[model samples]
Target chain A: MLVLSSPSGAGKSTIARNLLENDKGFELSVSVTTRPRRSSEIDGVHYHFRSRREFDNLRANDELLEWAEVHGNFYATPREPAERAMNEGRDMLFDIDWQGAEQLREKMQGDIVSVFILPPSMRELKVRLQRRAEDDAETISRRLANARNEIEHWRDYDYVVINRDLDRAYQQVLSIVAAERLRRDRSLGLFDYVTRLLDEQVD
Target chain B: MLVLSSPSGAGKSTIARNLLENDKGFELSVSVTTRPRRSSEIDGVHYHFRSRREFDNLRANDELLEWAEVHGNFYATPREPAERAMNEGRDMLFDIDWQGAEQLREKMQGDIVSVFILPPSMRELKVRLQRRAEDDAETISRRLANARNEIEHWRDYDYVVINRDLDRAYQQVLSIVAAERLRRDRSLGLFDYVTRLLDEQVD
Candidate 1:
């Protein structure tokens, strides 16, 4: 599964949506969460919203692939749905953060391919954060601090793309995904299936 | 299974070799052939030479993923060794033609990610062919004709990268492979394995 993780305002979600729109083969892996939805958020679309108790129950039962808490609310990935999609040969795209990515990587086989988006510099990060106009100075400051912590984990990912230019970064992300699909380990089963036919001819 | 295909002088082999030298995880899929070895070629490294009878035997049994004739000599991809490498979690890189890619994709479920390397223009391609200091003008012209025919298969590939500048193209190729590794369908089994552990937990 391809998990794209970046700090808030780094444009990971936008990139993921663009990739999904361009590639019909990709399926977005919607995360489930215990946090209350914003007015615009749609249940089962933006997220599968469960109550805190239900979320806790799911976690306790091991149904969640990976889960974590931020500001007292829990967010997680539902294990079953992603598996069903993959088994059906659909690729899943995840827009997440480093913490969630770390958890997902650990719980899964080394199948998780991760990419970290980085702003060109601290100055550029602040410029982008301010451009969003969604947060005030204080909130932006807090976010910038958190962003530093997140970017620190960039080394953990397979690719680190600097979003200095949106178009170039998007292309880089697309290329990475395209190349990964060709990975031999992922496609070895096809080799076996083809070899079986050869075996048939050998006898 | 990232297939990098281009015209005879497009430098795909050079890029593939560079990638192999730097990336330990990548295994070059050596082609099997019935052609005589040139003085510069090495057996089992550049290619595995086989007798016409053995080649016929492999073809009769469907052991080759793809096979074709060039200058009255035959070449093929031996299915078993490449498959084994991939099954063991290694990424295999193929420097083959479009026909080989098409055949391989048909026979197996390998990620089938193909990148067509294009010269900046016909003029550049001709210049590169001449710069090789090998073939005569007639051969170079024939190669250019062949390149145009081969490039018609670009739409069949997952990515199209123009090798205008070598370093930039190299980086783009690396980016493609890195992102592809993160594909969700490819990594789905990893997620399922992690979720299986949750089966023991109770709500």
Candidate 2:
């Protein structure tokens, strides 16, 4: 499991796309949200857009592993699908925060490996957020303030990558995901099956 | 930081040495212990062999992070020296158990990545122990029993690698260390420095 969380415009969305495009075993988890879609965003593909009432129902039904309100809107992961993917030995990638990562960790045992992406600096973060030209000045100021608070919880993650250089950050995250997949606890079945042949030779 | 732990003759020592040889920026932490030196072992290089009285004094004074009695001998890490190395930006590697790893985590605010090496199987573990040809059959049995208990704490570790195929296991560990060293928090200075350049350009 891999969770790549950062403030908006931190290049995590780009990094996530490249990772899923390159890696065969990984599936990007599409989140459901009540947030309004941007001009380029698509439903059921970019996000599973739902009404506030539906999101509220999911929260009430205990269906979400983790959920959060952002900019007066809601977003969440449907718990069952993610668990089913993990159980079948597929890796799921999440673009979420500490709250979601923590909840996922509790539900899964030794599977979640959270990586927090830090912008080069608060100044650079503001620049990147501004470069998008999507949010207004007030919204950008609000985001900068939120980013600082989010980054303070960087210690909660298993790994952290500063997105100063996009190529380097992408390569670092790719290596982490690849290395984690080969962990002995996760690949025990492969080891056991191979060792049986060696056992037969000895017997 | 990476800690590799396994029972004696489980090939963890060999794996640790291989990782050290191939990886740059990783230094093996030389431990100070009160154990009698084997004929082939070197002093100060392998271990700082201390007197029982000195070991007891260090343990009593709280200089040692974690110490354990095994076969009537004591072994521990002097916390100050290890912290100095880490503070100097060196990734100190440990060939220690879950107990020592836990102790290090509690005392230090640095990152800890533990890898538990599993023998191919219990049968192979027994074979590997017997192949050591150092211990008698009774001692080998005791070591095998101990390995089982150690493996039970596999969940406590962040990563696990099985030495089924030496080359594969070595590569897996190498990749993990490489990825961990690139963690964002440790590279914060680099990010801040780079961001300053960008800030200057914009101004």
Candidate 3:
């Protein structure tokens, strides 16, 4: 499983989107949230919007892999899809925050490869946030404050990518995925492959 | 440091040579060996040829990072060059056996990224060995036997690449190097970078 975490406007979302589009083996782990879905959001695509009761039930039943309560709403990663993806030999991409990445790593330490992305500078980050023009100045101020907190946990990740250039950051992410896939412990097929090699006639 | 280890005919030497030629940041850790230098081999380029007395002196003085006596010829990696390369912010490549890899790892556990290359099949390995026509059939047979012993320790490596296609395996290795460079623990600059990010004024 690949967990991608970054502060808002760090270009992680763009990189994640590109990875999903380009790599067939990877499927995003759509989160389940108790927050009201916008008209632009589709159920099971953007998030599986659920009632507070249902969210509580999932939490009680241990169906949530990692969860957080933010802005009086619950957001969580459902356990079933992630387990299924791993069993099926498909890579699962977790588009989450630092807290979510931490929870997931705690649950699945050996399986998780977490990456944290950082903006090149605070000025560039503020510019990117303002470019969206979706938030008011107060909201932007709150986000910048939140970003400092989020970036503090960059050391917890296995890899850190500075998003100075979108393309370069994305390419670095791709390279990381490729390299992690080649890790000897993860390649279970190597056992039988090596055995076959040893048994083969080499005369 | 990148350590590439493989049994003979697994294409590791070719990949190492290619990496040096293609990447400016990497420099091969030319080993010091007590073996007789071939007519085609250049001193200090292929290896730093030394006498048994000199090799023993270096070993006694603890100047060797990793060393092995192969078929009675002393082959050893000098510690100074690798330390110098690391201190200078240049990547060093170690083309060594499993024993040497283990020694190097012990000396620089956090810095060394070890990879083991495997040929697609034992037959293919034998074919490549034969194709070289440099060694007699007896020598080829001995090498094939030795390869099996070497391959048994593949589990010790961080990453394993099966060399079915030379170019593809080489590319995988290149990707590993790129990703390892992005590891958060390895990037010492990140501490100051993150500090700067947090301290910056955002209006």
Query: Which candidate leads the pack in DockQ?
Result: 3
Clashing pairs in 3: none
* Candidate 3 CAPRI assessment class: high
- Chain A TM-scores of all predicted models: 0.86, 0.93, 0.93
A1-203 per-residue lDDT for model 1 (tens digits): 88898888887878988999999988998998887887767999889999988998998998898888866778899899778876787778988788899888887767777888876566666778899886789878877777767776766777767677888889888887766664444553544432342233110
The digit string of per-residue lDDT tens for model 3 on B1-203 reads 99999998999999999999999889999999998897778999989999999999999999999898766888889999999998888899999988889889898867889999999889889999999887889989988988998999999999999999999999999999999989998887889999989999977
Q: Give the candidate number with the greatest lDDT.
A: 3
Put down candidate 2 lDDT per residue, A1-203, tens digits, no spaces: 78888877778899999898998778988888998888889998788899999999988998888888866888888888798898787889998876677777787767788888877766677788888888899988888767766776677787778788999889889778767766656665754553452343321
TM-score of chain B of each: 0.87, 0.89, 0.93
User: Model 3: what TM-score for its first chain?
Assistant: 0.93
Question: Can you write out model 1's per-residue Cα lDDT over B54-125, one digit (the tens) per residue?
Answer: 999999997888998866789899888778976787788988888888888887676667887766666667
DockQ of each: 0.12, 0.20, 0.87
Single out the weakest 10-residue window by summed lDDT for candidate 1 chain A. Answer: A194-203
Candidate 3, residues A1-203, lDDT tens digits: the string is 99999999999889999999999989999999998896667999989999999999999999999999765778899999999998888899999988899899888768899999999999999999999887789978888988888999998999999999999999999999999999998997889998888888866
Alpha carbon lDDT of each predicted model:
0.77, 0.77, 0.92
For each prediction, how big is the interface RMSD?
A: 15.5, 6.0, 0.8
Q: Which stretches of candidate 2 lie over 4 Å from their true place?
A: A7-9, A32-43, A48-80, A83-90, A96-113, A121-158, A175-203, B22-24, B33-40, B50-65, B86-90, B97-113, B129-142, B152-158, B174-203
Error of 2 at A140 (Å): 10
